[model samples]
Target chain A: MASKRIGKQTVKIESPVSIAATAAIAGPKEGDGPLRLYFDMIIEDEMWGEKSWEKAESKIVKETFSRLLSKADKTTGEIDYVIAGDLLNQCIAANFGLRDSEIPFFGVFGACSTIAESMQLGTMLIDGGYADNVVALTSSHFCSAEKQFRFPLELGTQRPPTSQWTVTGSGAVLLTNQGSGPYITYLTTGKIVDMGIKDANNMGAAMAPAAVDTIATHFKDTGLPIDYYDLIVTGDLGLVGKTICADLLKRHGFDISDRYNDCGVMIFDCKRQDVHSGGSGCACSATVFAGFIYQEMMKGNLNRVLFVPTGALMSTTSTQQGESIPAIAHAVSVERDLSS
Target chain B: MYNIMTKKEYEKYAEKIAPKSNIVRNTARAFVVGGLICVVGQIITNFLKSKGYDMDDTSNLTALIMILIGIIFTGLNVYDELGRFAGAGSIVPITGFANSIVSPAMEFKSEGFIMGVGAKMFVIAGPVLVYGISASVVIGIIYYLLNF
Candidate 1:
């Protein structure tokens, strides 16, 4: 009845993308040694005012890529290319930061899912023999972003508990034709999805429909059961978004309960952090992918990851013109190559 | 297993990390001061209600009051103490944003708007508000594209 009512066929798997390296920067305390990220690019929230968003983003990206590229150990003159994007306009933050570095670069955007989309594109590019090394990048700035879209930070607006934090950081991942690492196994193309949620302050409710679409597509294309991957991760659907996505999938007869989780909600343990539902932004998934999950993968605690990066494709202009939020999500599965 | 901290060890860690006596007293003081902030908010809400403002307006008015309180606490060096005790409960949302705005506004009073108060104000809350508004608007458009 619902399928007939919606009148849309389910989506299927198209291709997959690989992940190379992931890195994040955040504030630091010496006691946070075990949990300390390599770059303690701690910009206190108060100090993060409007201008700082772009500055911090540029700095994080520039520093991170510079460090990663410098360490790439280019024996042959075959240096890797960089594919990057951000939430900022024209991917300006990434463009400005990555410009100085001699990496062959192209900019892309997938909203919060920019990192995953870039990764998918990078992998496809490499697989197609277009390029061997590619880097995907993304970032979010709380102040400049707010002023451009909604009210200014000075408005001191209140947020609902269902809201997710927009991480004030940037992340970069380097993909290459390497010897040993996780390979991009498959990816499901995303379609625009919207379920009539209009309130700009409430995002989890907004992105849920896209999450449902991509997750369902992954199942259809791969013909793989939910249990196939060790963990099925969703990009920035927070607590509320995750719940809605799960319900929508269950209705489609593919249960993703046990293996399903969202990056937004997984970051700060909302109750402890008062981050409401969880974390959001390009950095939301990027930081977690680089920080916690990367460590786990390195330690061999888990392997074979199916990551579906979800994006909400809308801007302030479209909203002001009375448009609904259209969302897209790309699914990329990564697993350690046995040859390594 | 020896490397891993046990429940007992965690308990000890928590105790060791617990706020000291002076810190607890200061936090209590800060909470009392913070509670006064709510009192001010209530007074504003009541005053707005008396003027026949709607609940939404009154609530918004309360939020503004809270931000002002956050600024005062921060200036007085009491906001950090309040944060230690209330954890994110005190600092996460409104108060947190309040700290973000006022701290800079107070820091670079000379730089005025672009460089100082106006420019640096949104550093912390900017991303939250941006994603909040952007996500909301995007979802709205998706709804329209799929429907209207």
Candidate 2:
């Protein structure tokens, strides 16, 4: 049985590991990432407990991880490896959370592209018959991010509508090789595209072209039609970027508007969520992919999928130096058979 | 390390300079910096036109050029001085980012990039740029589909 049911197999990804993230540093650091991120109950301290971004983000990742992983199967032994990273210096927040996990880990920095990067690597290792299971995770916090890169939130600054809310959460997916899980079949590394856009408030527009380019490439390489997959999702392009992605695909002769959606927009209902525009950060796309959509696909709601996570490669220096915004996005194709 | 005087300390320093300073001279310097910034922007706009860019494209080009000029001034330590005298006249728009970036860069030049310059640079601009380009491409596509 060579398996003609590759595309229909039901694959489920779960998080049985528990983690708590808290930001340790609350003070400001330019381009520093977030200040305070911790797990468990956040201790509201004068310096950083409540107002410190470092503490908040650290707490978010830790708590979110703890909540997700607490339900994991205990027999899995020590986590083989904690594959994670953040935008901060040394990715200190990620480091803080993973330090006590007892599982060996490696730090990664792909900006917003971190979720897919980790997922691709984790999936590959499992597919190659190397590891039976792995946990892929990432996160970003607002306060820590602000102190590292922009004006402090205490400064009472108003962000433009194009700005994205850095999600204060962490997501983890337990990928196993032995289980009848959704097999991540192919992974495509995306190229960086700079459309000469510089406004920070308008990330969706800058990143949409990259999303289209990657999606079109995925279809071209796989010879898969737009309708082949139940859904084609992109990471964190918010409402504006999601719209741009749909139109660009249509222009390329691929009709995907009907089945296509974005994690950035889906994570937060615009009107109800009040997450101006939509969600972003490592956790924004990670949680949506690992939690909501992954659950849907497992329940036979969504079988074939194309997960494309996008990132913008602009630092404060480049923006200040008057360079155009450059962006990058990656896509992964996964298929599952329900009737193994 | 040069101790940057706080606002109160700067007030004390200002008193010492006030007696010898010429108000008209300061006003003229302010005009010069402001005028120069505009001149550079105009030159960029005209250059774009000569190169066959449309009006819309030229406006975008002009904005980009102005930002670059702002960055250059910010780098040379001149933008800050001009800004101090011009108030919000120079602090508005992309020029503010330029000033914000250059000051820290010059301060941490000795620390190298990983910590000093690279890490501290995106304080105000990172998220904006991240979401800006990402959203634009998406919006551009959406517009094409609904309208096209």
Candidate 3:
């Protein structure tokens, strides 16, 4: 048997998996953010006539999948598998989102890192020659997440400045063995790291070390220079985690400060939007990547990109029980053209 | 395993990086909002008393009216916004308690009235009531024993 393990926790694919098509949708507030124009669609009504926010999120995911299929110019019959996730409990959003499509679905949960978790799995299935095409998608809604993870929506509780707003959006990506130039070249799976930070509101602080650990591991395994990638972005570390991640990376003896960015920070102008820390949730990185990063690659602006979606694996029950948060991050490297 | 720092040291480090909540501003806002709520309660009490209501009846009526206002504010989605700006100012009053109950009730209404609104309405208040009643009973027992 042959192995594609590159180094420690990293994997080198036998052949590049192509990123064929992508779709992203944002809620009204996100649609008004700095990356507002990047989303394929912006939903004004959060409920969208649905009785519940969870059902509305499912609709968002379903629509994003259809848009992804249309962009890829393929019907559901041609798609082999669907790997998806969300911030909802029991992964209900993804489960119901793809239920009617008749696609073989794998529901994943990595908290906010769900998009990258699904994407990496989709890449593996295609590269392993087990499937021709797979769709990876994720969604999150603000109201649904808040009610589930924290307080009731109408409760007059004050959120601290470090608290992040769960993003209201969904994103889908189509991956195939054969497609355009942009390719998935590397993946580094992260280990759960708990820094003993107990505050659920400061997710950035909780997830930053895991993101930094994965980035450092990727560099070590690949023996790549820090300047190799044009951009290195984390999933949703927001303002605080981004700084901590950078400082932690510096301690690891690598500096990509000039190019380091976070999806949570990029998706919103925190100061103006009044999103204290920034945006979070599974959709934060998903919408940013599917809509913004991939489009930038298509335009030849970013040739090499390191995408690390970070997740805090703590549940409300765990947090209430006084267990500190355990965070994980998955890193996937995409290049415009592998040959170049 | 990722770093040499122990969990405690790393936690301390994380604490250093995270931005602190503006305590002075939050406290000041909470004070003003709480004071304003008290003023509103006083006005209602005075008006009710002027209408020939006794002190006890005026106090009870004022609390009822304040709770009603809290419910309306929560329904109109204005209380949460005020809560955000004023921190505990909007949350430390009788109106805040009303907002807490009505807000959760409204949020869970979509889950259905039985398990959703009915069961969840007392999530926060349940503990308050349990402890409040229990402590009152304990104090009453102590007073009775002393008199005997």
Per-residue lDDT value at A33 in model 3: 95
Q: Give the true-structure RMSD of model 2.
A: 19.7
Instruction: Put down candidate 1 lDDT per residue, A96-181, tens digits, no spaces.
Output: 87777776777888888888888777776776667767777776655445545654343333454555667666666767766356
For all predictions, the C-alpha RMSD in Å is: 14.4, 19.7, 1.1
What does candidate 3's lDDT look like per residue over B1-148, in tens digits?
A: 4575788888888788778888998999999998999999999998999999998899899999999999999999999999988888988888999998998899999889999999999887788889999999999999999999
lDDT agreement with native, every candidate: 0.65, 0.63, 0.92
**Which parts of model 3 are misplaced by more than 4 Å?**
none
Q: What is the lDDT of residue A299 in candidate 1?
A: 68
* TM agreement with the true structure for every prediction: 0.67, 0.60, 0.98
Off by over 4 Å in 1: A1-20, A27-51, A74-78, A338-340, B1-148
Q: In model 1 chain B, which range of ten residues has the least summed lDDT? A: B1-10
Q: Judging by DockQ against the true structure, name the best candidate.
A: 3
| Candidate 3: tens digits of C-alpha lDDT, residues A1-340 | 2488988898887687989989999998999999988899999889987989999999999999999998889999999999999988899999998899998989999999988898899999998998989999999999999989999988888888889999999998899998865899999989998888889999899999899899999999999998899999999999999999999898878898999999999999999999999999999999999999999999999999999999999998999899999999999999888754
Error of 1 at A21 (Å): 3.0
The interface root-mean-square deviation of each model, in the order shown, is: 16.0, 22.0, 1.1
True contacts kept of each: 0.00, 0.00, 0.82
Provide the lowest-lDDT 10-residue window in model 1 chain A: A4-13
Spell out the clash pairs found in candidate 3: none
The order of the candidates by TM-score, greatest first, is 3, 1, 2
